[model samples]
Target chain A: MIEDRPLIYKYLRHDKKFPHVWCGGCGIGILLGSLIRAIDHLGYTKDEVVLVSGIGCSGRLPVYVDFNTLHTTHGRALTFATGVKLAKPELKVIIIMGDGDATAIGGNHFIHAARRNLDLTAIIVNNNIYGMTGGQYSPTTPYGQRATTAVYGSVEHSFNIAQLAVCAGAVFAARGTVYHVRQLDGLIEKALLKNGFSVVEVISQCHTHYGRLNKLGNQIDMMKQQRDSAVPVEKARKMSPEEMEGKFEIGILVDREAPNYLEQYNKVRQKAKNALSLQLTKEEKEESERREALDKQ
Target chain B: MHRRKKPEPKAQLMQGNEACAEGALIAGCRFFAGYPITPASEIAEHLSYRLPQVDGTFIQMEDEIASMGAVIGGSLAGVKSMTATSGPGFSLMQENLGFACMAEVPCVVVNVMRGGPSTGLPTNPSQGDVMQARWGTHGDHPIIVLSPSSVMECFTLTVKAFNYSEKYRTPVIFLMDEVVAHMREKVVLPEPNEVTVIDRVKPSVPPEWYLPYEDTSFGVPPMGIFGEGYRYHVTGLVHDIRGFPTLRQDEIEPFLLRLFRKISIHFADIQLVESFHTEDADLVIVAYGCTFRSAHRAMVEARARGLKVGLLKLITIWPFPRRVVEPLTRAKKTLLVPEMNMGQISREVKRVNQGMTTVLTVNKIDGTMITPQEILEKIEEEKK
Candidate 1:
């Protein structure tokens, strides 16, 4: 079903490290496809790009990509990506994380990375449940969803990831579901092209654990649910909050230019250089004057 | 040859942390990630200002866990990287520290110690983390820990820590007590050309043939930095030569054994200790970090009183320096250990002495340095 599949295959490490661990009927493959297409569209060479991932199902995506990939500790993809971007700002750094990996254990790093406006594109796959660890409830699990950790059904509220990103001062924030392949690809490309901290939350499905435990039909039914529940931000803005209760808003929620951390840091470097040079000139002038005084004596 | 600005050779008054930061820069560290904690904050602050000037990157991570994670990432991206913290922050870094060991990622961690089981004291000197530096990370893997007795040693040992980490492909801990961290002393830093620097050995094989963790003649595989054309997997899972996770008994055993042997075989070069006046002595003071200063003074006074005494100052604390300590166990001499904590390294001393000599511990845990007079009194009382 993938058009230009041969072109996309060039971006994958299929020969050595393929047969990825994602389950069949899982939406991670579709979301990962969109991300690959986005990078491909941006014309970034494999050597010029780095994909950093944390632990979980989505975190395994970088393992299959043909870039300078880093598989880091759980809930720490953003921190690692920050280091890569700061160390070599010319490289295109992208981070892949899961719902639990991004907003739960790694929530502090997520918000701070956004607050600093680091030049990174973070894609958090929101499968609602922690799929890798036996379908436990995560921060993005809906209040009434059933998980292994929430057998009777969770009473805790789920986070609105896109809104959270905007609140954390991300220059670009967008949401797309795996069912909306074309739209998700477009959103990822825009996020990547942005020059500051960007987050694109892709609502994906884990039919094996999340669907079976919740008795949500099959994988196709889960995909249908995603398609039916997503409302464009433009339409959601015209509607009331109650109308958006059970649905999520897709499309960019925040897109604005702001000075990224590295750019500001470069300015600091320049200022320090100027100050040091000025001090050196003053010292040199005084030294020359002292030499003249010595000659006169 | 292109012209380069030469740094002037001069002795300047510098704090221990500042010297450490300078040492890291001289050792080719281009990235530093750390969370600010007392007794270790100056290292981060100095790096934050100096790293930028040197075109290096410095990041204050959200916490110590992320700090260590970032250091690993930066190191993998072909930069010498490090982080600094005190006791409470060190506790948070144990897991990632284990990841670095398991993945065989070379990085340096500077723990400027303060009193703590948990946040016990922030701005006080404590040698309490000596044991934690060795066993804090949950694993049986070997680690390198270097303790510096003075500001100059802090700089020299930090460079040594980086060299050992790069040479062995393991994490090295630069263990500094708060007394040494904050105390200012005149330090003559070696010019860049004067000091020895070791870089990670790069793979000679092509990208297609490179194995990230291949066992070679020296047991250390040549590491290829990311984006340098060699791409390979790295994980905390016990992996084989190719750096991919494995569960086979044969693969796991060889991989694990190689990691242990690489350091154990080099024990002669790894273990660094200084012996002072121990020949023909009935008493020897076993000390490390800041406590050694007091122990040295006590040994001088004890000898002045005509009691046979000496000091064995541990410059390298880990791999336990067994070769040096093993001989002391049979010398029929009293091993007096004075520490800032109740007794941490003393336990190791007693274990190594194995009842051959009386291992007496003079420990203080009141957020204060163990005075030389206190060590002298303990030696007198023991003699009586």
Candidate 2:
């Protein structure tokens, strides 16, 4: 099964650089591998691409990837990526980071980026814990989950990312867990190919810290929990509220056609250009040309 | 056949902040995100009108946070980007500032120094952010900050801000004072070709073997754009060369050192300052931001009377031109530090001087600049 990702083997320049930033038994590598697989399947030429990241343990993802990359400031990867996107609309912009990065600290950007529906794919690796800053409870940390700040269990309600993205006008939204590696890759690939804002919320695990505190213990056990708890979006949609309780959906939750923010923005721009051009008439333009011709003599 | 060389674009009297905006455009900055703030608002105002003219994007965000967010987002998308704000708003940008350092995003932030620990002065000049600009965030970090003393310098350095930001892959802070940001002056805008520009490094290696964190021959690694064919992960975590989240005991130290060294290696380009009349002067006046303009006037006054007084104007505030000050400490008998705030640059002066030179401070907190008369009086008082 690992051979399924010889694509990963070919990409691995130095196996020494790996074991990567993920903790022992961490699920981030699973999703990280899936991300690589999706890129390989799409056969993107790595040179022209740029990956921008916000702060958090997850933001570290870009440092490892070999390409034009940026590990941006906290919660500001979207802003930086937005700049890169607008500067060279020819380049592909990817924003990857943890829950703390994409949500709490970067929440304002997260909502606005979706609202604008910019042509970017934001892959949020929701490890629930702010691993880099120490396992602090983030906006996506489940209610009653024990984290560093939420040692007594989080009293705050967790956000449903897929629904929030949908409300924010993202053209595509999906949820995945490391347990569903293949499905996660497919969703990421689709999100990458999509023309507008696309978000794939990958539920990840931090075994060393998040697991110990929550009593989820060990890397492999955490992976199983995610597997058992995830209900397909379709299955959950058809199920009763009682049946849906305690089950997370893993699949493309909402995918639809929408005008990208750039196109809409460009339209406003095109209108201004046309108006300016029209203000100069064909008769006057031709007369001006004839005058220039006469002056040439 | 007499040919007129298309009237060399006439110079215009422009606001300092407006010149900064024009400078940004000339530097190839195609994305601007900023919320209007007094003094600095002219920058956003100018950008709003001009960005579209050149096919660039300008977004006025709800607040300074979103403005920085949008700026960072746009930059990562492969655009040269910037956002401008004064003290209060600059404080709001600190968290993201830390993020910018951790994530290694190249960008430019203009802090038109107003009064503050918090909302101190909206329209006044203060060098108070002198320390805040360096250690504002919560961590061990290295930052590149450039302070401009005049309207023309504001234009020139703002463009340099973008170049250094992209080259270093760090958010370069353009520290201009309220006076500098608002003061109007005649500026000759440079042609695009005449101005030096730096685009981010393209991927020199294949994507498969790419480690976004892998140190390049230049210390900084190549940056891959997001939507292009290459795909990689980026995080703010203390990780290994792979750029993934790591908890290795050995990772934190080297990671930070390299982060610090990346900028430190290019200190020559980063640390910029100018010394006028320092050659045989008995006294040296240390200043930056809007205060430098006043110091320049004071230098002329002192020199007219043959007071042997010199002025050391700081152009790059961050890697604090140590050599410039170190020599000044040994060569000069006294240093007069005049600033809008109680004493910011004064402390830096004292630190480098090692008490060898008496560091005099002409502190102003009345929401006004230290005048030439005030600085001259302070310099003469040091004589007695």
Best by TM-score: 1
TM-score of each: 0.95, 0.81
Q: Output per-candidate TM-scores for chain A, rounded to 2 decimals.
A: 0.96, 0.90
Model 2 residue B59 CA deviation (Å) reads 3.7
Residue-level lDDT for A75 in candidate 2: 77
Candidate 1 retains true contacts at a fraction of 0.44
Highest lDDT: give the candidate number: 1
Off by over 4 Å in 1: A2-4, A14-18, A282-297, B1-9
lDDT (10s digit) by residue, model 1, range A1-297: 657587668877765545778899899899878988888888988887888889999877877777888888889888878877777788898999999999999999999999999889999999999999899999999999999999999999999888999999999999999999999999999999999999999999999999999998899999999999999999999989888889989999999999999999888787766777788899889877866666666
Please write out the lDDT profile of model 1 over residues B1-384, one tens digit for every residue: 433334356689999999999999999998999998998999999988888777788888889999998898888888899999999999999988998899888999999998887988999888888889999999788999999999999899999999999999999999999999999999888889999999999998888888788888888889987777887776777777877667789999999899999999999989999999988888889999999999999889999999889899999999898788778779788888888887888888888888888898898989899999999999999888
Candidate 2 lDDT (Cα, 0 to 1): 0.81
